[model samples]
Target: MNRIIFAAAALAASAAIAYAQDPIVGNWKTELGDTAAIAACGSGYCITLKSGKHAGEQIGNFNGKDGSYEGKITDPDAKKTYDGSLTVSGNALKMKGCVLKVVCESQTWPRL
Candidate 1:
């Protein structure tokens, strides 16, 4: 019985660690230089602008794995949305977006 209890405890601990967010899965600055917090939302993730021009606006549905994700990011000031991609490495996060395949911009946001 003790062995079974230990095994169950180990399994639970491992599962908790697995579901925990990666380093980049927390607060960050956006391309517009605004601060936002990213959190799990419906099998993916959603980022809510914490400050600057887009405060309180949430960008949702970034689906990916292994530090790369893609979704739609909206600019609250301009009220425009673009196809956005995010790549995270260590303490740096690179975000890029294309505007209708005509123009694109990228920015590297350092962890906060």
Candidate 2:
């Protein structure tokens, strides 16, 4: 009985950990004509919390409007940063992050 109980508990724990992996648990690139870099953002306003290459980055968050948000991105390694506003369309994470005040690049990528 003790062994059986332990086995059941272990199974449950493993299942839970597996479920914790979000849908956006993969690599994602920015769309064309946009500069800000982004990854797969899971459901419910979830965004990637990145470090190393891009640290201290930020994006915009809108005022209760769908697909309207602001974000800030930082790449400590590259010693770079991107700041701008964006919106998530039906199948894209649109970004236009910039430095100081310049819109450099943007792109659309399939969510991985």
Candidate 3:
């Protein structure tokens, strides 16, 4: 009985660790007024459009922690991919995409 209790405790600890997700895992309202979902995918997070004209499209993939990330972001309308970085603070997520690490555009997405 003691071994069983120890095993259960170990399992609970492992489960807690496994499910300790980042704050960026959730849905947000994009600058375009659409909904975007960010969820864990493999070793990184994937951003997908959950509403509006671009629904069902995956627009970004990022890898990082503590509210900062770096990856590539794709413009659905232009069909272009750019180097991107993201920062999350409070209920806002600032997304930036750049060309050659120079010219860039940014948008702040609110948590949904």
Best by lDDT: 3
TM-score of each: 0.76, 0.42, 0.84
- Candidate 1, residues 62-112, lDDT tens digits: the string is 878778999988767777889989889988888888988679988888888
Q: What value of lDDT does candidate 2 attain over all alpha carbons?
A: 0.49
Q: Please list the C-alpha lDDT of all candidates, in the order they appear.
A: 0.81, 0.49, 0.95
Clashing pairs in model 3, backbone N/Cα/C closer than 3 A: none
Report the error of model 2 at residue 108, Å: 2.1
lDDT of residue 84 for candidate 2: 53
What shift in Å separates residue 107 of candidate 3 from its native position after superposition?
A: 0.4
* C-alpha lDDT of residue 49 in model 1: 86
Which scores greater on TM-score, model 1 or model 2? 1
Tens digits of per-residue lDDT, candidate 2, 4-41, equal 99999999999998677443333445432223434344
